[model samples]
Target: MKQDIILKRIEEKLKVLKKARPFPPYLVKKLREQFSLEMNYNSNAIEGNTLTLRETMLVLQQGITIKGKSLKDHLEAKNQAKAIEYLYDIVDSKKDIPISEMLIRNMHSLVVQNIDGVEAGSYRAHDVRITGSKHTPCGAFEVPQKMHELISWHKKNKDNLDIITLATEFKHRFVHIHPFGDGNGRVSRLVLNILLMKQGYPIVVILKNEREKYYRALQKADNGNMEDLVFFIAQAVERSLDLYIRAIESSTKENSLVSLSKIAPQTKYSAEYLGLLVRTGKVAGVKDGRNWKTSLDAIEQYEMNLIRKKK
Candidate 1:
């Protein structure tokens, strides 16, 4: 699919979600804790941290270290949680914090503060090569200049590009520079999300299961083709949008609603078809456990709109 079309669909869902923003404080708290655990686990896991999701939760929440797990692994989980908290602080701040070299460095420092204090917030002094890849990062001496250029580019083009494009391009360029000797991947992901959250979009989580595919997308971006990466990132954003939308819908009190299966007999569409519509935000509905529940009136309204479009 074309990037513009996918982005347009994402924007449509975002509109619905934005209207429901400042989600109930309890829901907001729940989402924050949930995404923090998932994000920390996945981000660190992709970097070869040995902690599983459950183990990460244990380390972060209970301070219960796993037997035989490396201290670095525990620290990675803890530091990432701190980094996530910092990201949210920036997002919630009264003052707007534009993306900058300092912001990037601060985030990197948070990621590796305990593991490598000397180089935590500092750029590398030696050239580095990415393992298992053909891309060579800028020389150590050129790191500062390249990072300056990246920030300038963001300021110049942020308004012209859509949020997904802007964030994905920034991630690609940042990783391409590989400014830091270590923790570049973690910092890149944090910066990508900072750009997104600043624009009011939900944070995108790159799952550990997608490790190979995510690397391939970055490689493709290095080759000057960023469509795959943009789509990959967009899908994650879409999932976040779906979660928020479903939560908002379920919270509202309404009568005369029924499951898609029950409404199927009253409309021309099958339950499967209506379920697809609900999932894609084409119809108004709430997901009730395993089933999509919606009002018959919503289905009728959607049918009427389709008829009008056809005419």
Candidate 2:
């Protein structure tokens, strides 16, 4: 039931975003800049990069290296940003772009260019295991064949499946393939957003703060369960949608995310309870630092559902 509501909201937001095209140049520039920073920071952070979101902005936009951060961390930020730009460049220049293995390798090459120079774009040459998971990655010899099968699977189902399911499944499958020696998670996310962008959906960021939950969801998918993983991706997609719409419309009251305490006053629930709902996936909200933020619009939807359930 919660998943349905979340997916429905995603469609609604996506529809709004689609109708707003051809998006203005300024809007595109604004959003692309913000999402670039977001993708660079959060994706690297998930893989244990230590740069805070602000520090990421400094490194990418201002080229100011932090005193204590490792050069590798800075390189990860810059490399990931370039990977994001590469995707945007292709999406802008091409029409009906099919995601091919070549494109995947190209993105991987950008992701690990200097970090892992020798094997930047090549598939791993040895067996790899997912940390803290029961599923073992395919042997090095199988990476090529498995990746070929993955591309084939995507081609076969790309159009038939809904957008979230298609992108999310492709992401998990890519990470499951674990083709690269390192940077699989980061590359998987980059490719995932490219697929989303190809279909006109916004860049979906799996949050750094939710890193543990994200992994657990993947582990479950490895065990043949995908519901949790789908919703996790869905929430991120919707959040981006919220941001784009709020920016485009310049109307934050209903679309913008506010602290839970502010949102709680508008509904019958208390802030702590709403936080619980956010954590348990009963409502749509985002983790901002130590606090959780939700929109009044989401709480209203929850209340409306409650009324319907009673009737």
Candidate 3:
């Protein structure tokens, strides 16, 4: 799909999400905790952290050490949970925390605190090369200066660019700079969500299963082709929005309980196709014995996502 069209659909969904906000405090907390576990697990997993989602949750929630995982693996989960909490604290502060060098450094520090304190919050002191990529990071001496430039560019263009584009650009450039010796990927993802949260959007979790595509998008951004990265981020945002919409709709409406056959007539898709989607887990739903039961909103979101993908 074209970047502009993808972004327009994301913006439309974001508007719907904004109107659905001020979800009950309890629901909000529950969602945050759930996302924290998923984000921490996926983000760390992308960086070679070996903790499974259940293992990460066990470490974070129950403080139970998995028998075979490395200390660094456990620490990565704990540190990322802390970093996510820090992000939320900033979001809930009602204080304007502009994207700055300090904020970036602090987040990086939280990410690497237990693993590498010496360089946790500081920029690298030597040139670094990213593995499996042709792009070279700026020299250590240039990291500070380039970071300042990045912050300035964000401040200047934030109002001019749409949120998805702005967040994608920031992630692309930040990773391109490769300021820190470690935790760059994790920190970049956190910062991306921070930018989205600042704009009243839900956090986008880039799954570990998407590692290759995620890396490819970043590499494309490095090559001055940002369309791929933008589209990738848009899809993630759309997924989160769909989750929010489904959750909210399910809570408020009694009409959420419906069979695939019933929603088929309301959508352009055939019942067989809708049933196929349910069986394949493309649509969010529960099974009532042999039949697939799902919410109307889920069908709507599924159709909208399909339309966006085709465009």
| Count of backbone clashes, every candidate in sequence | 0, 0, 0
* Candidate 2 off by > 4 Å: 251-311
Candidate 1 wrong stretches, greater than 4 Å: 254-311
Off by over 4 Å in 3: 254-311
Using TM-score, rank the candidates from best to worst: 1, 3, 2
Across 1-311, the per-residue lDDT of candidate 1 in tens digits comes to: 55777899999998887876545443566578988899999999999999999999998889998999999999899999999999999998989889999999999999998794348989999999987678999899999999999999999999999889999999999999999989999999999899998878877788999988898988999999999999999988888878877866675435767888888898888999988887765677765556667777667767788899999
Candidate 1 differs from the real structure by a C-alpha RMSD in angstroms, to one decimal, of: 11.8
Better candidate by lDDT, 1 or 2:
1
Choose the strongest candidate by lDDT: 1
> Which digits, one per residue and each the tens of the lDDT, describe model 2 over residues 152-248?
9998998798888888999999999899888899999988888888878877777899998998999988888888888889988989999888876
What are the per-residue Cα lDDT tens digits for candidate 3 across 1-311?
Answer: 57888778778887887775545343465578888888999999998888899999999999999998999898888899899999998877788988889999999999999684448889999888898788999889998899999999998999998888999999889999999988899999999999998888887899999999988988888889988999999989888888887776664354576887887788888889877776665666655667766667767776788899999
If both were scored by lDDT, which would come out higher, candidate 1 or candidate 3?
1
